[model samples]
Target: MRPGLTIGEFATVTHLSVRTLRRYHESGLLEPAWTDDFTGYRYYTAEQIPTAQVIHRLRQLDVPLAEVETVLSADDPRRREEVISGHLRRLEAELDRTRAAVVSLQRLLHPDPADLAVELRSVPTRTVAAVKGVVKQDDSLSWYDAAMAELDAAFPADERTGAPGGRYDNELFTHGAGMFTVFRPVRRPRATGRVEVLDLPGVDLAVTVHAGRHDDIDVTYGRLGTWVVTHALAVDGPIHETYLVGPRDTPDAAEWRTEIGWPVFRLATGTPERAAADRRR
Candidate 1:
């Protein structure tokens, strides 16, 4: 038997097509061990089979050609592993996002629309330890985790007065990027890292609780918005979200509760006194 396998034989041995081997050779990804000078025929040695299999596996994972090249050419084994690990991390994150989307779609398709219960709460001015970020909507979730982690490290559980909350600016929804503030209601709030003491102004809020995870929280927001429009005018302010029970409280998402608040003034016959009198009834 000949020492050099023809391209077709190599393709058969590696479960790769002849056309793919030629393309790989053309891209300088997998050059043949030997080439005929006159006929321009390509041949591979048995030693290249393991490399061919590795490249095929990487490609099967949908790894980018550039990254696959990096893994192949990297001198250090650790560097090759780093490229593979990074891609795996990205795949995991994408899987989580896909799972969340599937759950949301299922809920929407077979919805059990229940009447939303809203409460009018008169909030008082309070000082809290907070972390703020100016970020795009796409990055809000990651930024929230980082900022909330910072807040968590600074304040012990015993020091917290109430559930953690966040304020979101309108520009985040309308203009793609805006300011976000995450705060923990703490006794003797102080500045640490990104965390700062913020004096939150008092306002009346029409609040409703959203059950379960945030994947379908938008539906609750829609219902609350409709309730606000019918009952009272929406006052211009950042929207508030209170995580009454979350991952920190319980691993079970079914037990999670989030309070959404829209700042508002009571509707009445056009005067502060009239609104005050109506509230007294």
Candidate 2:
């Protein structure tokens, strides 16, 4: 019988815990080269050390066990690389989320009043090319991407009259699913595929510019809502957002500027206290 290193000896050489080795075996990720019939002791060959190291590295990166198995089981080098690259991309996205969360937390702790600013403006009626769909709150970003891409491709820069904008139904925020509409003011509206020409009615709006990433956009919305309730009565309408500068304009997220607009009416004959009370009801 060709003798191999015991689990303990293998763990020592691989710098992996014996418990981890056992877990890897139980998960069918890395099985031992031999097992004693009487004692049931597990042993691994020196040749398997590199495989163990690879598994260890993947685990260190917090790759799911199933994905690790897929990566290791793949016979083609390109297939293995594709699997690993996919996981790495996911890790990069997670890192971005974490960084955004940290920045948001810092802002919450500091509580800067100057970060928020609200204004009132009257928008003129315009004919636009738009895409509308029912989208889940979680899927809003990707839906926006697809909708905006369609709009951009349908109308060239010369045809575009103004910045691209979106209108989100209140149900989206209140019920987690609702209609999302993206529009672009065109020199002349033309229907193409999912894009359709439509006239947007004008309305007075309480507007605010939300600068940078949307990770904490809810804070800006809260501030705008407060301003609307205090100075004006919020009317029945979807929330509007004009993308003054966006991903299509600049790759740098810090340079992005979005104008948030809440439709409203001037509060008629009431103190701020009464308006606040009425809004609460």
Candidate 3:
């Protein structure tokens, strides 16, 4: 009943539920300036109103409870601003990533069919420097990151030195399997570490160029699969992906092109047993 307000009064002023204010009090993020021992009631002074407003603002910013506590406890306004600004920067970066993913999804759902860019290519035997590893589709990101790191460490900066790429089997894509790969470009050979250099003999393959965010690359795969089937061809070997341009080289998604190849053979109006036996030699 003094000039100060009770917990309920403070809650009304703050526009926060009494329960939430009580939680903040229990969490030590906010505390009453005074308490009535016999009544077990909490009381707050006018000075405490600013603290309540700050808690509301920080919560609105999605700041973590621990971080909010740090900002609240800091005596210097500059220090508090620094902490909030740092958090805002991180949130902005996350927003950008989310926006990119959304755009990529939209492109996937509604792709330009008129630009049905496809080609029949005959790939020849060649050498490639690579790192090899077996990885599940879900963990492909980690696997690829490790491979690229190793390749980058092995090779110096140069023009002929292109982005890291891989070849994965249809089984891996269609029915999640341990993805295997050689990270760098090297000459064709019989064996090389877990990564073996083998010649991919010249075979006419239906090729398609998928351009955009890697997050939605699956759309290209699905479309290309239909292309192969419609043409009466069955996948013969592993799916090979050549990165003509990469994020490291450019931030523009439209400029990124992934050459997808489904090693195929002419289907004779029936289910064709996998022609090229899966092997690493």
> For residues 1-281, could you state the per-residue lDDT of candidate 3 as single tens digits?
58478899999998877898899999999888887888979888888888899899889889999999989889999999999999999999788778867877887778776856667666666566666655688778677777766666555565234555677765666677755674555432233334455444455567887787676677777788887776656556878788888775688977888888777673222332332222211
Model 1 residue pairs with clashes: none
RMSD of 3: 6.7
Q: Over the stretch 1-281, how does candidate 2's per-residue lDDT look in tens digits?
A: 65899999999999999999999999999999999899999989999999999999999999999999999899999999999999999999999889878877877787785745666677888889999999999899999999999999999999998999999999999999999999999888989899998888888787899899887777778778977766647888999999999989999999999999999764333344565467667
- Displacement of the residue 35 alpha carbon in candidate 2, Å: 4.1
- TM-score per prediction, in order, is 0.80, 0.84, 0.66
Pairs with steric clashes in candidate 2: none
Between the candidate structures 1 and 3, which one is better when assessed by TM-score? 1
Provide the lDDT at 171 for model 2: 96
Q: How close is candidate 3 to the true structure, as a TM-score?
A: 0.66
Error of 3 at 174 (Å): 4.3
Clashes of each: 0, 0, 13
For all the candidates, what are their Cα RMSDs to the real structure? 4.3, 3.7, 6.7
What's the lDDT for residue 132 in model 3? 63
What's the lDDT for all of these models? Answer: 0.88, 0.89, 0.72
Q: Name the lDDT value of residue 187 in candidate 3.
A: 31
Give the Å error, residue 168, model 3.
Answer: 1.5
